[model samples]
Target: MPSSELFLIALATVLALPWLIWRLGRTDAWAPLVVVQILTGIALGPGLFGAAFPEIHRTVLNEEVIAMLGGVASWGVILFVWIAGTELDLSQAWRERRDSTVTAGLAMLGPLVLGGVVGMGLLWHAPGWMGPSASSWQFVAAIGMACSVTALPILILFMERLEILRKSLGQRVLRYASLDDLAIWGLLALILVDLERLGKQAAFLGLFFLATVILRRALPRLNPQDRWFLSLVWLALCALAADWAGLHYMVGAFLAGAVLEADWLDQQRLDRLREMLLLVMMPVFFLYTGLRTEWQLGGASVFAAAAALLLAGVGGKLLGLRLAGRILDWPPGQARLIGWLLQTKALIMIIFANILLDRAVISAETFTALLLMAAASTMLTIPMAQRAMKHFQDQSPEPSKLQSQR
Candidate 1:
């Protein structure tokens, strides 16, 4: 069969399979369509599908076809990351700085400490887990940071599904997640720091600041449509500069969106654009991610590693939240509920692991483990949160009853 025909078949399979499974299986209560898509991507990768049928897998996902899919996936994630950055509500986080900072800080710290221990164990056991170019500290730090990530975009979707996105509690969660999102990228930048490229990186930052000031000033004068177009132009330029500076394009992508005010864009349109991107572009990224997964260290080892990381990530998050609850004097059960919600690691963690892989900070086996951990952590979120939420609501009095008592 022609490569073009094979490419179409590959695309169709990726796009169709996940939706079919999500829609037919009705996994939304636990696994959202996005999670399903991620899992599907993993299933279609060499680890599962290729392992089962090597010839067919190779034919359909040929080198040419894979490259084509990669192009789509790259742009898709870039836009998605940009949107995530642009949507950050730093002003709100600033307003509730004390609560947000404490919660976010503890939440991130717990997972980092626990996951770092696991990373160390992996390093001690075998060199296979660490990438070729990675130092001991880099490997450990990347794993630790992976556990700390909260997919801000995925968290927002979950909140919206629970019908709490606009509520006070949801807003608080968003504030905490937003602060962590900022930290995740900052740490990634630190991890990617290159002594040889230090001068270029410094120059890039200087130029970026100057350009941001000019862009911010110009944005207010332009019409809304022009603002949107110009932002895309900015996104591409920032991504290019960051990559050239030895920072990843994703670092640039996030910075591109971070400098812009969310209010400058039409919120509804931005929301729709996000939806469109997820619907169309992100699945390709997921597929691309799946294709990179390898079981070179053996399936059992990868699964065991994933299980260990998941335990560390989830257990640490809960413990941290519980401590924060005690310090903040939060009502009983509220901490656990917030902890489960924040345990979301679907998109961002995978992206973080991908960068680690690209930089050779972690091996493919480790990436696969992190990917598995992310999927499982995300799958656990909705159900655990729902139960916690129900218990919380049951414990608290209704608004009308409180009013009557008053």
Candidate 2:
């Protein structure tokens, strides 16, 4: 069969299977459609579906077809990350600097510490977990950073689903997550620093700073339609330059968006664009991610590693938020609620692990484990957050009562 025909079949499968499962199984209460899509991606990978239907898998996802699908997936994820960076409400985070900083700091640090410990253990006892190209520190730091990531876009989706996106509590959570988002990207840049390409990386940063200044100034003068077009042009340019510098195109994609003000675009349009991207483009990226999964270390070992990472990621997030709550004098149960919500790691952590894999900073087994951990962590968020929110609402005084008291 022709590669083009196989590619079409593969694309159809990627787009259809996840929606069917999510819709039919009614998994939204515990697992969002995105989580279900991620799981489906894993299931469709060489680990499961490939194992079950080797002949069909080989025929449909041959090298040429996989490469074609990869191109589409790469752009989808890049645009998604760019949108995430653009939507970051840094101004609001600055307005709530003290509280946001403390919460975001602890939230990240706790996971970093715990996950680094886990990384150290993996290095010490199971050296196979580290990629051949990775130095000891690179492997450990990548794992720690992966644990600390909070997917700001995914968090926004969850908050919107929970009906708190425009509420004060949700706004506060966004502030914290936004701050962490900055830190997460910064740490990734640090991890990806290539000594060999030091000059090119430095040059890319300088050029990027200059380009950002020019673009920000120019964007305001253009009509909205032109502004959107120009932004894409900028995204492509930055992505190309970053890849040339060995910093990775996704990093470039993110930085391209981060400098822009959200108010520059129509808020509704931006939201709709994000929704459309999730509905259309991102599932391919999810499927591509699953295709990379390797279980050569044995299924038992992979699951065990994933479980350890999940515990570390979830436990550290809650502990950190609890400390922040005490210090900030948050109302009862608020910290726990916020913690569970913020612990949700789907897209960003997966992207982070992907970069590690791309850089050979982590083994494919480690990447697979991180992928599992991210999916499980995200799956836990909605149910656990609902329970905590219920307890919180029960303890708080009604708005009407407070108004009457006033």
Best by lDDT: 1
lDDT, candidate 2, 247-320, per-residue tens: 89999999998888766776667778888989988899988999999999899999988998998899999999
In the range 216-263, model 1's lDDT, one tens digit per residue, is: 999978999999999999999999999999899999999999998876
Model 1, residue 310: what's the lDDT? 97
lDDT of 2 at 299: 93
Candidate 1 colliding pairs:
none
Q: How well does candidate 1 match the true structure, expressed as C-alpha RMSD?
A: 4.1
Off by over 4 Å in 2: 394-406
- Where is model 1 more than 4 Å wrong at Cα? 394-406
Candidates' C-alpha lDDT: 0.89, 0.88
